[model samples]
Target: MGWRIRNGMSISIWNDCWLLGFPVRKVTSSQSTQVDLVSDLIDMDERSWNIDLINPIFNEADIESILDIHMSNSNQNDILCWKGEGSGLYTNLLTKRVSISNFCPRCNQSIEDNTHVGRDCPYARKVWRLLDIRWSDDASNLCFKEWLLRLFMTHNKGKHICIAVTIWSLWFARNRIICEHQYPLFVAIVQKCRMYLRHFSIRTHVLAWWKPPLEPTTKLNFDVCFSYAHQKSCSGFIIRDSAGFVLGSGFIHTHHITYVFMAEALVILQGVHFAKDIGITRSTLESDSKKIT
Candidate 1:
């Protein structure tokens, strides 16, 4: 029914036989085959689902004919979309489930919507500005799918990927607030996008390289304590040999540093110093702060 209105297509609701076409079905009781059905449903192509729900005439057999693909398994209990996501604080932090609380997390006035976080939220807009990308308030005011398609259409491949990373970074930033009750600065969010994109490049076959880099040949192993005292933040950095023996360590103190970047950069600078201090030329760095490195 939603699909009918979505495409401005008309369909007869009177036919019970036609209703069988809907993938929204209740599995039979005591049937182990429900797993298979679920697996089939999960494996079904996005386009096929669009067709079945849109046409409003295709039967179950027709749906099957449309799929015609092999099931990964007859036991479909493992079949899931966006697996490993569960109902928890972290899950609630990421997804917006239907509930009473719809107010914007930051503004506390506007309804929290996909577009708000992806483009319209003032925090998100600030983050975008820091990246040297201007947001068209009028264009970004559109809904999620429309905004995404527009970005994909208007920008180059690299810019599109950057857009994806930007959106993901914004969502991750929000999650930080929901999970840890810490509000990060706009610069930190942009820096996070850069770091994440760099790490992603290493993990995946995405980018060739990042600027101002020497391949991170030197490593700073830190088992340091982090603390904020007397309005100053401090951390310790330790450099270790290949055998895990401690070469040397140093203390890094920062004033008025609320976020992790200053500490991270200080640790790294101390690491390079430790490398020079210990007469070691090249090494790799490791840190317990996984998010930082």
Candidate 2:
């Protein structure tokens, strides 16, 4: 982990990996001093690194890395982030499992990194084009995380949401092709997504955000959050009315799930049974996994 330095006040000079490197983030030389925070090493007025202070304590390589770090002119708080990738939302399927050919299963061209699967591949690009969402020309060049950040920064809420859903759908489509050995037309997928997007609306001041279902019908949104450290996962579902009122909600612990995709599928299956137990027949089941209709 590393700090995306802004004000540099909260980050430690010798502690935080604001230098944005791997293995070790702290200064290599054991020469320690009163320098606690990176704030002391910055010229606040000029919004640049304090060269004199930095040069004395750090080694030549460390000094160069520290200077290379960009300090934003704005006073935004320092943000601690994963240095490995810019975006964490796009899942690299190969990352969680065994090694294999990095080539994209759908395109058979280019290595299937997080960015390629989410945006750069011919399949993903075609999907984005059909979605009518405008992206920068350099969109294909970025890693998945950088592309997502640019989208969120440049787009309004509705457009960003559409972009996010498209990204998720792209992953789902890729998994279906690989896991189920099914090949469906991209246009059919786009049309189904459009139907959902049309009904999505953000409610004002609502902590739990979701598009309300049609009157007399409830929406069941099932999802799972995976935690490898604990070797367990939490699966959850919430039912909401047309007015976005909470009709019912359920969550349970799930373990031994090898793939998050599989866990999500199980949650949807269990969620459907959960909804039925309450005698709600007219309900719409929603989930990030496109495994089920």
Candidate 3:
């Protein structure tokens, strides 16, 4: 799985497969990035590539690939896609099922039935056990389909999703062993599943309603939009009371701002000073950035 960047907030800069044509489907020029997300490299307001920043950080090939990615003018978040395919239909993108050996590819000790390969196999059992969730590993009597049905009947909806992802990951591991003659480490497969889950976790767990500040204390929410190509940023903060009344608000469009975190920090600092100027004694700072607040 890979990302089709819209706002790029969801895609990782150094690790995700945003850049096509690369062997690992990632940036080869830089092994690490100061910024976390690919959105940091984009000029969000202008809806274009950050050319000045891109030229210096990435190799020529990667730079070209990044530039080729078109930016949508809409406010939609980054999209997760399979192989960055144009059709955007998962049904066609899936690998065609092929026949494999009757015996388990990894252990070769047991018959490779759907139930045995997915659960009873030594490798699959280890993969499930390594997962953070408490799993009932003794579903040996149930077939794969019945086992899934029982799991859904017992667990919550969230656990069902986790179980589905775990099964898919196990299938991937089994496929590798069958086709490539490669036995993936159980830990490695589990790590990939966790990373995939982490990406969705942010969007999935959004609050349905906002909780206001207590009594007289105000909430100061600060945000920043940065452009690396222009070396400029637009930051703002809004202060509101428990009643949702906007008490004070301000914004700044400035130059020479280089990094996303710097912009976020600056906005937060400026917000505090702004609140102080407005005579807001007791206030709670709020920001979407995990690094800043």
Best by lDDT: 3
Instruction: List TM-scores for all candidates, in order.
Output: 0.37, 0.42, 0.37
> Which segments of candidate 2 are over 4 A away from where they belong?
1-97, 202-293
**lDDT measured at residue 250 in model 2 versus the true structure, 0 to 100:** 61
Name model 1 segments beyond 4 Å from true: 1-100, 135-138, 200-293
Candidate 2 lDDT tens digits, 1-293: 24556677776766554564432356666657758888888899999989988877888988888888877655544544322222324345467674556788877979887788777788877787898876788875776667788888888876876887787677768756654456767897787678757756532333254677889888988877777776666777777677776655666566677776677777777666656644668888876555555
Candidate with top TM-score is 2
lDDT of 3 by residue, 98-148 (tens): 333456768889876667666788888887778744446565577677787
Reference-based lDDT, each prediction: 0.50, 0.69, 0.69
In model 3, the runs with Cα more than 4 Å from the true position are 1-100, 132-138, 205-293
Model 3 residue 247 CA deviation in Å: 54
Higher-lDDT candidate of 1 and 3: 3
